[model samples]
Target chain A: MHKFANPTFFMKIANGIFPWATGISILCFAVGLPLALIISPPDYQQGDTVRIMYVHVPAAWMGLMVYGVMAASSAVFLIWRHTIAHLVARASAPIGAVFTALCLVTGMLWGEPMWGTWWVWDARLTSMLILFFLYLGYIALGDSFEDQERGDKAAALLALVGSVNLPIVHFSVEWWNTLHQPAIFGLKGFSVNAAMLQPLLLMVAAFQFYYIAVLVIRLRAELLSAKIRTARFNLAAAE
Target chain B: MTRKRRRLYFVGLGLLGLFSATALMLTAVEDNIVFFFSPTELKARTVAPEQRMRVGGLVEEGSVNKSGGTVRFTVTDTVESLTIQYNGILPDLFREGQGIVAEGRMGRDGVFLANDVLAKHDETYMPPEVADALKKSGNWHPEGATAQAAEAKPATTSN
Candidate 1:
């Protein structure tokens, strides 16, 4: 684990897997889209509109899952002083933000036709919205400081603080009466029909692979920018 | 681990724990959380009178009566039922035995005077799933399931 903490070493591993991640992501989407929209049964209540669940549910799950990754990486960075962990956390913020936003926007589109409202401040919805803002906050704070390490530490701390929202988002339906439905897949076990479950799970895998592919690109960019900074500093010292 | 690394762990855990405590407390005490209350919760002391809120449960079978633009219905958690009156067009998804949420203030007469009434599930799912679990205790009448049940079977009706 310590050996893998070097960014260059990690990049080599990431690059090796990058092609596979993209290939699998595309394959999942290819199968998932049809499975979700065509093969799945029209719901007794929602009819064709139920197809939106394929996108909405996976996006919501990824948004939370990505944030969990970010927080854990931040903890690793803070405790072990692994700069690679900070880079990983930094790379994850925008992806998490986009996923959270997708979840919210898709939620609105699904909500309007179904729940008769575009938005509600119910605990689940509000907590999810906060998660979106937390991502934005992390991104902004990551770049706010003049020193990169200072920015990294600041963002890492925010990620840790924001993690409290994870459990709240998961349990808000049960702990408080929320307009949002309690999750179908939970510790009690999945009650959803297998047909719907298959497509949803596939879409979730697609989203996760998508995140990995994008994260590698982002991490590489960060590493290059750091390299450029070091080169310019070396040139100045010689002059 | 180095002493500095050990100290970092302690600080991180402490901050995480503090934030969780604050969030949990805030969620527990906030009065504006107008998410649904079971009919029994409405009948009891948890909710203050006339404080605007949303009540949710299955629309009792045979209890929905629409007259002109106003629709009157009973929302039952099976343990108890609350009568609700809404003076506007209900959403297309509103049906007997379907889970419905209505937002409005209660009256001195105990009726939930709803300004807005809507279905709780998207077209494909049912909210009364949670309510149905409560209804199995005996007071829940299966009669009046005249409205199609909200369960998510494949679309069986030809449009």
Candidate 2:
């Protein structure tokens, strides 16, 4: 892990993996979309509206999973003082925010048809909204400080503080009487039928690979900017 | 200790304090955070007449009746049930023996006066064919059985 602190080495590995990530993500989407949209049976209750879960659930999962990655990388940055770790956290924010936004939008679409309300202040829904805000807050706070290091530290702390919401978001349905339903996949077993689960898993994998491909691109840009900043500082000192 | 080690400890302790504080606050506000109350909870706790709240449970089988613009139904948590009267459009998913939540106030006449009605579906999802097979085999039970076990039992037993 410490060896990855070297930017050149890190980029080498990232470049190697980027093509594979993009290819697999596209392949998964090629298969998963049809499976989710056309082949998978309409729900006994929800019919075609159930198809929305293919996108909504995976987006929600990505939102949470990306936040987990962000928080973990933030921890690594703070503890190890690794610039690459900070870059990883910074690169993750916008992508996670988009995924969260997708989750919310798709949820509203499904909710209007099924639940009769576009939104509700239920514990699960409210906590997820907070997650979205946390991502925005992390991004805003990171840019607020003029001193880049200070900004990074502050944002890292915020990321750690906000992690308390993750468990609350997950268990909110179980802990409270929410309009949202409980998790179909639980410790006991999947309550969903195999036919639906297959497509859902495929979409989840597709999203995971897509996140990785995008993260590598973002990280490369971040590295270039850092190099430029350092070069400018060196030129100023020589003058 | 080295400076890096000290920073690590400082960060670790700060996080610990933050988590404990959050945990305490969440516990303190547990009641306020709950989205709705079941019929059993409503009955156990005294609520002021006409106080706004949400009640959730399964729509009792054979209990929905529509009269003009008003729709009346019974919501049962399998332990206790409440009569709800709503004067609005129900969601597409609203049906007898399905989960629903009604937001309104308790009336003076013992019926709940709901201004909004939202259908709450369970977690279970399957193809119509699988659902039919489950029904035919007499093994189909709705998810969250605690709330719908009574209504679902008779159908299963008859089969």
Candidate 3:
């Protein structure tokens, strides 16, 4: 772990992973999207609106997964003082936030015809909303302090706090007598048919690859920026 | 291993503490996001009558019918119509020719049975999907009395 902690060594590994991850993401998206958007049959009940699920479900999954990643990275950063982990957590915020926003918008679109309103005070929806806000908070706190280290620590703290919301978001639909639909994917017997399930799982795989791709690129950029900062500081000391 | 590492360890512990607390708070409040829908989209896309939805549109003028506890009306974006049925008493803003949103399931009989209704009491409002559907239908007229008077009402409103 300590050997890999060297930023130069990390960058060597990251460079190799970046292209492979990007290629995989593109390939997954190309295959998964059509299967989701066209090849997959509409819901026996929802009709065409079920297409929104392809976008909405994966985004919801990304949102939760990214937060989980952020919290885990935050733990590593705080405990190990790993700069790469901090960069990874920082890099992930905006992408995760975007996915959460997409989830909310697509959800609103899906709910209108089926639920009768554009918005609802349901368990699932509310927890997701909070997740969105948490992402926003992480971004804000990460940049809030004058000392960059302080800012990073603050954001790490925020990410850890926000991680707890994820399980609640997943289970809220079940615990409360809300209008939101119950979980389609669970450890108990699966509710979704094989046709819809296959594409959904594919999309999930695609999104995971996409997140990894983005994180590597962003982390590299962050490392480069830090290097530039150090170079400038040394030049000033020499002068 | 070193003092700096020890310092980082404490910071990690602090983050874990903060994370657990916020997670609890968010879980406690996890019941507040609402969904919105327009009347026309509900008509075109909703295949199952029993599937739940949130239906939004202007309550057509003179279309609201009340018989005892039940109220029946046609929600319109002027291009498409969806019938709504609500059994409970409605809010004061639930008026004919006003923008309202209803949440419930579509009955197999092409009627929307609302469990809850929300009215946009203010004037500066139209459900966002109304504009989207109208754009698709090539009927871009803004809804309200002035616009209704300007263009010929569509085929369904006369019913």
Q: Which candidate is the best by DockQ?
A: 2
For candidate 1 chain B, the 10 contiguous residues with the lowest summed lDDT are B150-159
TM-score of chain A of 3: 0.95
**Cα TM-score of candidate 3:** 0.66
Whole-model lDDT per candidate? 0.80, 0.89, 0.73
Please give the clash total of every predicted structure, in order.
Answer: 3, 0, 24
DockQ (CA atoms), all models: 0.28, 0.51, 0.07
Candidate 2, TM-score vs. the true structure? 0.95
Worst lDDT window (10 residues) for model 2 chain A?
Answer: A185-194
> Which stretches in model 1 have alpha-carbon errors above 4 Å?
B27-31, B46-50, B122-159
Clashes of 3: 24
The lDDT of model 3 is: 0.73
Give the TM-score of chain A, superposed on the true chain A, for all candidates in the order listed. 0.97, 0.97, 0.95
DockQ of 2: 0.51
Superposed model 2: Cα runs more than 4 Å off: B145-159
Candidate 1, chain A: TM-score? 0.97
Q: Taking the tens digit of each residue's C-alpha lDDT, what string does model 3 give over A1-239? A: 68787778987897888888888888888988898888876653356677788788899989998999898888888777888888888999999999999999998887677545678666677889999999999999988899988999889878876777887788765565445656666544334444566677888888988898888888878888988999999999999
Name the docking class for model 3.
incorrect
